[model samples]
Target chain A: MSQFAPPVVKIEGITKVFGQGETAVHALRGVSLEIEQGEFVAIMGASGSGKTTLMNILGCLDIPTEGDYWIRNLNVADLDEEQLSVVRSQLIGFVFQSFNLIPRTSAAQNVELPLAYQGVSLSERRKRALAALESVGLGDRGRHEPQELSGGQQQRVAIARALVTNPAMVLADEPTGALDTQSTKEILELLHKINAMGSTVIVITHEEEVARAARRMIRLRDGQVVEDTKWVA
Target chain B: MGGLGLREVWRFAARGITANRMRSSLTVLGVLIGVSSVIVLTAVGNGSALAVKQGIEKLGTNSILVMSSGGAGRFSRSSNSNAKGLTIADAKALNDPATAPDVKMAAPILNASGTCTYGNLSSTPQNITGTWASYFEASNSPIDKGYYWSNDDVVAGRPVVIIGTTVATDLFGTDSPLNEVIRCKGQSVTVVGVMKSKGSTGGFQDADSIVIAPITFVQRSMSGYGSLSQIQVEATNASTTTAAMDEVTTIMSAQHKIKAGANADYRVLNQASILASSTTSSHTLTVLLAAIAAISLLVGGIGITNIMLVSVTERTREIGIRKAIGAPKSAILTQFLIEAMLLSLMGGISGVALGVGISHFTVLGVKPVVSLTSVLLAFIVSALVGLIFGGWPANRAASLRPIEALRYE
Candidate 1:
């Protein structure tokens, strides 16, 4: 962690257990990590290695069973569901393997959804959504629905949605998992472009090629972090 | 924009409905059928009640009829030659201002059924009344031609008759019945006047088929002389009909000479009181029919709830996506609730249109009367039903965890 810049995400011995006693499964076991502002990091793990659990924790979709999780100096572990939602809106953006665009809605509307939750004015939302789409190289396709777009284009729309709120961090789970090799490459390059634009980006993936595109990589095994490494790409 | 407004919520709800056209339409159809039935049934109830009121009015809003019921002091010689029931004496007593000050005119009615013949035509008259000349004035039966029996005709027991329009048509056809001679119940009577037509009065009695003659002539010819069945008394106005009824009762009781606590042999039927009581009962019936029809609304509400619950489950992933993108529970709740409201509102509006159209065509013997209060009440209630029935499913959708929902297939 750098001394000058506060970490966008800070974790300290966070643990998550799925159920109580006898049948209980520890999905995240006392894992700790810090990611600074504007860093591009990849989390690598095999199946059942708690990668998704950790990602869910970081995204504030679920509360940890133990320990502290701070985003932008606020203790997320201490926050309620409502406050967590606000924090998630203001600080984190999420992208999934399926793209997750509302099926019948246009690309611009998908991007504008987060702002709608924030209660933005209509014209302003339209402007920001269009700008976000333009930044993701889908400027002309804002009115196109998801089904009308290719897999790569859909992922790009999902990326635009993530960045639309100008969040502190973007969390992606197997974002390129459903894409062809060329689309996968394109998605990774977009993430690089996003990270370079000074927003923190974190990706969860099992593919080595996808992980290598990030400046740092962390691997999980048996619900515990087994390796953490830094690299220049 | 951090949260949804009313317009945005509505738009979102509309989109959700449009997305699943078949399901949404089926839910709306349920509510439509319910609301339309409510409107139509209530209208029918109201219409029938109004018809009954008008019939009573046509019967004469200020008229009261006193009839003997074979109790104490029966005076009619037709019932018992020795025993006394209602008679022409009692009718004259009721007509006297000193005995019944509220009574405008009291006409004694002696009933008979008779076959009347004019030339080759012969038909049974529905009403053969033995009454004085005052009967036409008291009963509001206008004279279309000739005249009623004069005091000379009654005193001499002359067989002169005043025929109603139906009797006139049956016996005289297009020819004038004035001064024509017709045989009634084998008694030859001259038709002195023709009573004007009093159209159908709906289930009470037909007034146009009557043949009225001098009470003396009717009593002597049709039954034992001096026998009478009823006295129809008209009050000065509608407001005093009850007072007029009480006055008639007191005079009759005195004429019968029954003790203070004993029941009188006669009964008085007051038109205003009957109208009021019938109105109350029919109002109750209308409400009952409306309540029964409201059950369909409840069933339709349940249909909306069921469909909404299924929709929430089907769109689990969509909910997850919305939640993950920072939608609060209130937003999700609002979305689903608005969709439910829209479903019922659409159904309600269309149902009202259809109901009004159906009522305008007039069903049954009465014209259906659609009241504005009922239409507005039905509409508002339908919207409330959406909110009420949609509550549980909307809460369920809002309560779903984003992570679990995202993972749902």
Candidate 2:
């Protein structure tokens, strides 16, 4: 990676408040962070530590109340809801804790969802979806629905979905929270392999073991960054 | 925003609907009932209207009738006190070419009910109308068998009669009644002609259960010859029927010494006016039936809205998944809207089939005539019902925030 390249994500004094007046709850209070390209980072926080809220902001699913947030040098605050959706489709990928695969849909179709939203032709989407499934070691299970697949296999399909668009970064919100220990190990290894291939990966977790798998760790306490540490290979 | 293609939108909607087969089918049945009722009820109304119009047209479009309003006692001159009854003089006046140029022919009539017998087979006709031979042309009664008696037979007061198909069937049982002598009102009358069948009108009056004879003979034997019962007039053409009616009215009013716009003792009725009034009434009935059916369609639309609302609630997480993956609001909206439209459209098509199929058979003694306009209108209205009622639920699904929707259990 070039040293002068711009960071993938940059946020300055980002605040998110719910409700108004005296009853308003401050979900995020003046948080500042930057994430460079090809970096593997883990954001750690306890429940109510605003990690989820921050993940939402970074994924462009939400807007900050009082801050300037940029994605690849583009100001996100100026974009409308439609543009934000486009940014989500083309620029970012999300992995939910519960492996949010659409019910009654095949694994290949689930992986092709983002491309479908981007208006890719049917033949091209099918080809790319099959390739993505193959990359996740489930090429033969392309036609299997989420209900038929195990937790680890479903998580692999989700990771394939997250990488199908070749997004700038992948944001995982407790991706291993709903899996067994063995499934969690497999998912963490998959994330590591994706990072080793020069793709940016961000993992959000409350577990110390999951944090240790990433090269860098940022801890949040009461909506503020309490610790930032980097581990050299 | 670039989003799912139209084909994909429709595919998603189809899948969504098929996911809940029971509820979707029930919703479709609701719309089906509404649309079918609209078609069937309107068909019945139109059928009855057509029956009435045919009845009026059978009396000859250019024919007019003048009848006395002086009550039933006009048959006996001594019982009638103040009101003057119509007489043969009024008929002669309307027949005069100099005074009533539009009148082609006018015949005075005397009506009586009598038991007719031929060789011990007796049948009582609904009415025995006594008039000139010109009555045959004015009333559109063609001869199915023998010939009609002429005006000379009327002047001579000959006992000559023409029987209708019903009376012929009852008396002869398929045999020809021509040149046979029948006893009518204790008088022997020779059967000269048999009129063609005109069928029953609106299932109330039998146009074929009638017998016609010379007016002079009827007055002399059956009625007392006090006053004429009715005068049947024929106009030169259909266009001159109103002029003919006016001329008959003017002559009758002058003969009865009735001033202009005063209460005349006689009433003039023309086929055109009866047809117009009947048509207007039937149109009103058709509209009323259609309006009643529309209410059911509206209820069906509400059923769609109710089901769609439930669907949105059930599929909140699915919508969130799609939205989080970058599905545009329009995609969500189109998906739900297409689902609703598919339901109503299927109902509309099947309803048309059911309604048209039912209309082929007679219902409640009335043959239903399906109007094309009603069918098209019903189908179009059903589609519109889906669009209008589906809008609210679709918007609700579309406007839901991704985070809140995903958070919903």
> Of the candidates shown, which would achieve the greatest DockQ relative to the real structure?
1
Residue-wise lDDT of candidate 1 within B1-409, one digit each (tens)? 2456666777678777887899999999988888888998899899989988887787688889888766322244455443467778888998899877889999988888878998889878777888887777778777888866787888888999898888888877888988888898998999889888877766657778888988889888986664467888899887888788889878988898867988666788878778989899889979998998799989999999998998898889999998999998888998999999999999899989988889897787668999998899889988987899988999999999999999998
Top-lDDT candidate index: 2
State each model's CA lDDT, in order.
Answer: 0.87, 0.88
Interface RMSD, in order shown: 2.0, 1.9
The residue ranges of model 1 lying beyond 4 angstroms of the native Cα positions read: A1-6, A19-23, B1-3, B71-83, B119-121, B143-156, B165-179, B192-201
Complex DockQ per candidate: 0.65, 0.55
Residue A103 deviation, candidate 1, in Å?
A: 1.1
Per-residue lDDT tens digits of candidate 2, residues B1-409? Answer: 2446676667777877888999999999999999999999899889989988998888899999888776642453455466787788888888889889999999888888889999989989988889988899888888899899999999999999999999999899999999999998899999999998998766577889998999899989997677877889999999998888888888888888999878877789998888898999999998998899889989999999998898899999988888888888877888899888888998899988898999899977789999999999999988987888888998999999888888889
Candidate 1, DockQ to 2 decimals? 0.65
